[model samples]
Target chain A: MSITKRIIPCLDVDNGRVVKGVKFVDIKDAGDPVEVAKRYNDQGADEITFLDITASSSNRKTILNVVEDVASQVFIPLTVGGGISSVKDIRALLNSGADKITINTAAIKNPDLISEASNAVGNQCIVVAIDAKRKANSPNGISWEIYTHGGRNSTGIDALEWAQNMELRGAGELLVTSMDKDGTKQGFDLELMKAINDKVNIPTIASGGVGTLEDLYDGIEKGKADAVLAASIFHFGTYSIKEAKEYLSKKGINVRNTYD
Target chain B: MNIIAIIDYGMSNLSSVEKATKYVAPNDSVVVTSSPREIDNADKVIFPGQGAAKNCMESIYDKNLDKIIKKNSKEKPFLGICMGMQVLMSYSEENSGTNCLDIFEGKVKKFKTRKDTKIKIPHMGWNKVSKKNDHPIWYKIKDESYFYFVHSYFIDPIDKSTVIGETKYGDIFSSVIARDNIVAIQGHPEKSSDTGLQFLKNFIGI
Candidate 1:
């Protein structure tokens, strides 16, 4: 059996600074991305995801230097996403020591990109990211639509179906974020997450709406997600990785127990 | 001088183990070496491993550390971790044809669970270890102290008396096994926190 229940800390990098906000509002620069990533790595984060939120729109270099700087400091896996569209971009990220590359809007624009990227990099190195928002009026009744362009554009593509297709295209994992619940701190969208997880055999990492430790637990236990990704709670030091892991261990969630 | 020689068998997280040993046994000498001679001369030996069990055993054999480890076990303190602990068993069902160190008369078997259960494989993360006997290795640790574990196969001790600790997944399994001077833990003591650190300290004293 593969290793499951990963505790990930998402770094939303803007202008090379780590920033996070509630509901994507009042975005505040957290700290240096390398420094913050080092802190999480020292604290025992299972994996680190660096999402360059500004890379796509600004066309700025995805901070390969910063990725290299952080990767050199830690031994755990590092994943980079945002503005990663082509196989070349994936190559650049991998060359910089990124263990995985997450493709979001590019995957939505050209579904075949998944197959191309997977063919170039191993399937284990390619991750498909789905930014989903709940829709009430779909024919299926309460459907999840794919949002692209950094959650600015909504493509009517059903998230559940897209996830299944991406897996078939050889995506090793799926990073699913609920647009409605992102940065809300309320919790993860369990219904939408379960919808995708039930259909795909690959690992699904639930993103957005993580306010507290309970919210993360819900994403793993109730949402049935293989991993839970959070930003604000971890960014502000509201909860340490050790604390969250201890809480999960007490709940019988099979978390890495480092505590005495 | 209580020199702690951590076996460097090309496994993951060896640095972390060295760091943790340093943290616990600050004044004592802690060195990670693949040399069997160094291991033989060390006051204590720690066998830490990750990745596959068969691969780990092959590494020990390739480096000719098997005889050294077996010989040292009779005279020095030893601790095996994760796949390290699994490899101490007689054989593993992992590769089907590979034989383990056979130090302990037991087989490393895969976790048996029902299909409908939500339990995932590779049982990653922290869990509590129930004491089978109040061994000195667990000194300063409570009855059910939590320790970090990441593996799929577990040792089924043929000599239950050697089992020092047990942890429950879907079922209760051997977490730590000790026979005479050889003490092997299935969890990563370096990654594991205070209790794990204290356990390492106690092993050093032994």
Candidate 2:
């Protein structure tokens, strides 16, 4: 089978509305989650990932409604994440038409959650999200620490090792975000991605530091990631999904062309 | 109304293919159906696929689509994209347990590359396609136009005349094949840009 490169648009939802921040500060309300999702879908995004950045706190019910609204309108694959902790939350999201559920803080807090969710739903339905920051100490010495509460707290677990364990525990995919690179537009942390991907068998999506199409190419080509996920670049109209795919295609990177 | 029937066999990327088809063939009829009867009656047929070659062929057999495809290919325009195109070859080296559609006289072999190269196992990227035969599908696509490619195996046609386009990875490989009413592209037209869209339009016109 041909492995098609996926162009994923990530919607970070806060209080049921799409919001984006630079360096995770001064957050501005982007728009309604459902409306923004519809626009991405219409523009030919291969997949839509809705990250309920505030689901752990207030607006839990609102996230469900947002998922339902977007899921109903968008015909493409929808992956919901953020604040997805328990099996019941996964079941609810899946029942609401989410094709996959991504777990981060919950998985790190209780590693067994990966196996539990996989068993309840299915391995393919479970995506383990790893939010990491590069630390000065440690071998590869770039620490694979896990961040929680919308990337505010760091759990001192090695990110690469934890990713390997998650795959062993039955995560069908991994979403590795470089907290250091998030919203930076510098480019994806290729070294960090390669480290995690090298250890895990499941598909890994490299998040953060996606400034240009070259960054995406480097993420997949050099980092060996299965997919590249970005927010501000796509959200702020730095580049449309079509433009990104075309650039990737021209560079001889396998991407699903929107024009096709 | 140029109704295009996408042969659905429970594979990945079908939804994306359907959406792209709708974009290009807007105002025309487009639907995903597994029924042989519906496929036989459609104006045109698109076989979009992803997954193991064996499983895809098995799905076709389970649905009794082999005979339907044989009948339709001779009668109407049939386009196969990616793995859909690979299935058209005589056989595939991927998992020797299953037989392929064998529509084209070629064998699908795994790509062989030198260790010195940084290229990965699965040839994934937007590679240029060198057009050979001036088929209708090549319309508006300039010589050596790039199309998105993602596959580990490629078709080696015994009858070189059937090869319409070639792409290079470790070596030049058949990227597009055409024979009578059957046209298949290894790269995704749905994912390709204006050139890829134009190819779809030409195929629809055919």
Candidate 3:
């Protein structure tokens, strides 16, 4: 009836291998990016995000190889994050078959990177990934502050204001991860998601800390995110993308039916 | 089994489309190029693009692909996608109103945005597209099947008969248009998973 909220499966990659436990059967290699991605694709994942956790620059090729492998077989949008600093890096990833590239610390270091990259390649391919951590107490009515280096450091940037600025810089989408809720399984930072969604017109992907399928549904319902990204739930085979969509669809969330 | 040319007017990342097309039709020669000669010689031509309408049109002109596109749409099987589909319209309100290729008498209008409604701009995500008028592209694709869509604007064709498919955000809008040898889809079939792959397969077959 209307646009279905996207359900994206996040794959954490290190040295070209999927680092998380993908409990899907028939997967010959646990670390093979293609195998894991193909499994997600078969399960009806709307899109796949590959985050290279490796800080080693040499291992960058491994991620590129992984991207090329999955992209050749996976007939869905592919988003790559981590180490996307320069325009050349973005070009390389896109050439290697990434549909979109996410820039985080680099963009914060140089805000112009968002503008330059979006100008070079359409904004649709440039996603500004923001890791937000709640700033204890604020008199200014601020909810979250941006974090960097995998949530290891804080940038002291207001999440909402930065979101608006990124949108102004022509970011196609925002992938906001709540450091507070992430890995806690407590659910997404709904307050942060809603704030970003309300401030910017571009699409926002709600991520970090999804313990249950109900959390994903609430992300769209309460957070009002255009898409939801989760790892442990889908990665561990605890739930499939099809199951997730069916759950959301049943809740009047308007999700795509994984299997037509 | 065929030489498929994906028209690259510098408006898109043509890899996904080219890869999807190649995955579906491995035997076919799928090349992403702005060269008019390649488009002219191909058995099937796919017009896939994204970005502003004005920029896309300007790129098409810069590449001198307008004549080839116009010629192929009439004589050969052609499938236009997203911005590609938009450019085929008579005009667009984007960029403070811009002129298009005018293959069909239509205008691309932006979706209304309000502070109160949950409806977001760009209409970004998968949505159900119902068949308005049946065609080969709908071969095995069921009516109201879900497809990927991510755009702020949509086309309004003057001739409703040409609108083969429709989707609703706040109101019903044309999602697919077809006339003669040309079919334009507002959604990205390449990124659309199985349903989209099937649609592209049908286009390749045609």
Candidate 4:
């Protein structure tokens, strides 16, 4: 009766190889992005997100080729992020059949790029990714601060204020990643997700720190995320998307439930 | 070979729709064009719109593709998606108030998100479409199948008979409508996985 919470499997592709984030035990040639994408898509993943971690321009072509190949075979929504800086890059991905593209650094450095890209492409296809870390010693006593350069640098910008600003500047959705719990295999920062959800009217995706199926449930239940994005749990073959969806469904959460 | 014209007013990104159509009906020639003549000669038309209804109407009027679209809907197996479906209505409450194509009698209004429910705007992601009537487009597809949706406003058609599928978000709203030769949906049949590809295949068959 209501909109189902989305389960997105994050693929960290580097120079066209599914290198570090995911570790599919069953599939042959696990490094291939196209093969891994098909595995997830067949398993009834609500959506697929590819983070192009390649550093060189020539190497970025590998990610683009991966998107094109998978896009032809996979019928669900595909989102690509990481190192997407300009409107041209956004258009290139969209033209290659990427349903949505997420931007993190560009969103903060050039805030106007959000509005420009939102106007160029519909806000529906534009996603603003926020990386936040809890403040250690707060003079003002705020909970978290937005980080840039993949949690390497501090912006001193409050996460809540940045989220609201992005929404006002025309971001359709917010992808909130907790830098503190990113790879810890701990649970998500429920307070951070809940706090961002309360401040923004747009859909917020809870990312980082997902250890088990229970973490996925808490992301929606207590964290209040519209969708849950996990990297290692899905990529490392800890739990299939179907099992995650089934667990969520059995707990009375509305998921697609179309997977047999 | 029948030609399928995917209407592009330069408002929405048409690559996925165009790609899906070409993939499903490879034998048929699919063209994404704003040319009125190309649209008129096509056997079927797919009208895909996004962003705002006001801008959609303005672009259509600017390029003079409105007349051709209106003519094609009545003469071919027409499909409208998202904002494409919204603009088929008589008027829309989006952008304060904007006139639509008036092909179908309805009013498009914004989603009223209640603060308590935490229901977000721009209803983005997949939801179920419950069938209300036996339309050919429902061929082989089960009732209440999930389809992809992304929009802020919902449509309220005057003629209830035209509504073929309904979906619930904050409230139940019309998701699919069928009348004459026109078949329009608020969801994207192109991006909804296997079921979606089947939908396009069925439309191509029609």
Candidate 5:
């Protein structure tokens, strides 16, 4: 059967606390990771993602502890990312109760890490996160280029080409974040999403830029994303996951009936 | 006292299944154990698995769990999930072909997505499961209600009567199958939110 579109809340964690920022900088502390996760769980969030934005060696253990704490409380699927460079990191996070591990910077540096981790674990548990921004003028005329290190550096890798390579390398899912749309809250980069969604054979999660309920709708209906991942919208109390589901359901989007 | 033993063959992180079972039926003793005696003696057994079928079968065979599962499924209430459900079939095309538990007459085939088709493999996300028959497990979960699924292969049962629920991806496939004391689903009910908890509650109550 066809899958219903998902609405996920992405919590950027730094030093064991939930944080958010604009284009991966100017971070703002949101609240306790466990509390926010539990609330999202109660609100019927389709899934939750814990992104360790700190990307620091000292904060690595704290993030794992945070994952354990949140995993114990949340019943839905949990994905942990940030600073996951090797198969060992993937194993540690999965052991700590994360359902999936997202690899970003490490994957760009060493694309084979995607296949290595997927082979060690199942492809279903491996998520390759691609951060990109629209490139207007390029040698190859590619519309987007991959950005890494929290969107601070451009890798010059064609976004579409990288997405195809990740899928070929056995990535179960793709988390595509549009750096231009991050923290803007305007809407998702529909063009970028459509480009990757049309080519990739695995589910692609559209991240960044979700301001209104309609943006979430467009992410799936127009952008063709299997799941919509947002950060500030759900974290800052602008809207609830339940509200988003109700809104999507009203627009004829197949959403889980969370009627308690 | 209802003792629900979730057979742990080291194929899955049974913590979520145990936690959900406990949440649904607090009075019941939900144990995640590979002990054959515990599984055989329990009032009900929950068989949950994930990952590749080849690796899953290897672990099951290593622990000689297939025999225990087959023997217990006929006598007590049994629930299989994801890979746990697939292994109940006759065979799987995964891992260059692997023989399954042969409890059901069916074959597990991988999704064949054509180049022009937009259907994605691994079918990861939430989808509606249309109920075909009235069962205790369908208690609060409405017909065609959305449930989470993440799998590339699906079961094609020979006996259509055994299928209690069906879902549509590229083609319609059996998402939920039931016969006598056994109930199995392709979706992970533990990961499915509240409606899934209700499904577990129905199984526990039954």
Candidate 6:
């Protein structure tokens, strides 16, 4: 049997509530994160990811509580990211019902965190998220640089090289987000996704800039992504998870039939 | 008492399994414990685990749960998940070769993918599993239904009769093995969707 392509609904949570924004700004409240997650679970979402966008030291406990709440209600694999810095943090999140922990900012600060966390926990549970933007003026025509702090700080690190290093450091999966296409409703950055997918042997998830059902298919067909994650389109009811899967199925892409 | 014991040898997230069990059988007591005595006292047992095989074996060895699990597997209905299923094999190729409980005659081999294979390791995400034989545990879950899977290694049961479900990832392998009173799956049914929960519900019913 063919492996089914995954369609993930991501919740950018802030202070125990789900939030949505356009291009990471002008944020607005969506609804109760737990209720929203349960709805997605019913809709046949392959998995759910919660990113604590405003994850601060004070709100860490709140996020953990939120994760616990979501885990108790929803049965799909839950991946949590944002403000996670150390193995202790990763452990806490995993214990609080997160199936996988995504590290981006802290991983940028200390690259060894990926190796260390993978060594402590199995690589299957560690996901290194890379927020990247296409750089046209770089030495090579095809290049992207890494961004940290919610896509604010620009680092000169090459996106492709960073992806390779993360794999070497024992990352089980990579959540590659194209900042340039994020929240634009334009579609995924297929070039950036193809660049990383060709370089890494691990499962890669294409995130950001998903507007239509066609974009979801392209992310897997053209970009060679193992999974696709989205926020606004799913959160605002622009499309249901069932509709997306049925559309993919009609397009000849293998998707898990929830109705069957 | 109809208590369902989910053995927690300090590996894996037992909460989801516990929640799924509770969701399916609200009246039954679902406890996550590493205590051998509790495992023996329970009416049914669910053995679940994750992480490296070496570490998992070490935990099962340290807790002295291997014998209890083996003894209970023959006495009552037992279900295993992911790493839980691997430890039942004779040996695993993870962490530079780790010996297992040898409950079943098989070995766990890593997914060796060539450059042209085009299949990613750790086979994470959803895949369709086809039933091999008729059994109570296969109740409502449709034939060749989709289930969530995440692993680099798949169990190779020496006795094909023990394999009740099969899935293909680069190569055909045993995804669910059942014989007598025990049933195990490589997929995480707790994380799978409604159909996955239905598997757990069927297990509890059996």
Top-scoring candidate (TM-score): 4
Q: Could you tell me how far off, in angstroms, the CA of residue B145 lies in candidate 1 after the best superposition?
A: 1.8
Interface RMSD of each: 6.9, 7.4, 1.6, 1.2, 1.8, 1.4
Q: Which TM-score value belongs to model 3?
A: 0.96
What does DockQ give for each predicted structure? 0.07, 0.06, 0.69, 0.74, 0.60, 0.74
Which scores greater on lDDT, model 1 or model 6?
6
| Per-residue C-alpha lDDT of model 4 across residues A1-260, encoded as one tens digit per residue | 48899999998888888876465666788888778888898889989999989989877767778888888878889999989989999998988889899999998889999999998898999999999999998786658999988899999899999999999999999999999999988989999999999899999999999999999999999999999999889877899999999999999899987665
How many Å off is the CA of B180 in candidate 5? Answer: 1.5
Q: Estimate each model's TM-score.
A: 0.69, 0.70, 0.96, 0.97, 0.92, 0.96
User: lDDT by residue for model 2 over A183-248, one digit each (tens)?
Assistant: 788898888999887776566788988999899999989998888898888877888888888888
Off by over 4 Å in 3: B115-118
The residue-by-residue lDDT of candidate 6 on B1-206, one tens digit each, is: 48999999997767778877888889999999999999999999999988889999999999999899999999999999999999999999988899999989889999987765668888999998999999998887789898999999999999999999999888899999998999999999998878788899999988
Best by lDDT: 4
Candidate 6 local Cα displacement, residue A242, angstroms: 1.5
Our model 6 lands, by Cα RMSD against the true structure, at 2.9
* Candidates 2 and 4 compared by DockQ, better number: 4
- lDDT against the true structure, each candidate: 0.78, 0.78, 0.89, 0.90, 0.87, 0.89
To one decimal place, how large is model 4's interface RMSD in Å?
Answer: 1.2
- Per-residue C-alpha lDDT of model 6 across residues A1-260, encoded as one tens digit per residue: 37888999898888887777322112233457777887777788899999887646787688889988888778899999988899999888888888998999898899999999998888899999999998878775779999997689998899999999999999999999999999898899999999999999999999989999999999999998989999888777788899999999999999888875
lDDT of 5 by residue, A44-145 (tens): 788999888775697688887887777666678999998888998888888777889899889988999988888777899999999999998877555899
Candidate 2, TM-score of its B chain: 0.96
lDDT of 3 by residue, A1-260 (tens): 37778889999899888897988878889788998888888888889999999878877788878888888898888999988789999988998889889999999999999999988888888899999999889987768999998899989899999999999998999999999999999999999999998899889999999999999988989998889999999878888888888888788887777675
With a 3 Å backbone cut-off (N, CA, C), the pairs that clash in candidate 5 are: A1-B167, A1-B168, A1-B169, A4-B126
Residue B109 of model 2 has an lDDT of: 91
Q: What are the per-model numbers of colliding residue pairs?
A: 7, 13, 0, 1, 4, 0
Across A100-125, the per-residue lDDT of candidate 1 in tens digits comes to 78998888788899998776555667
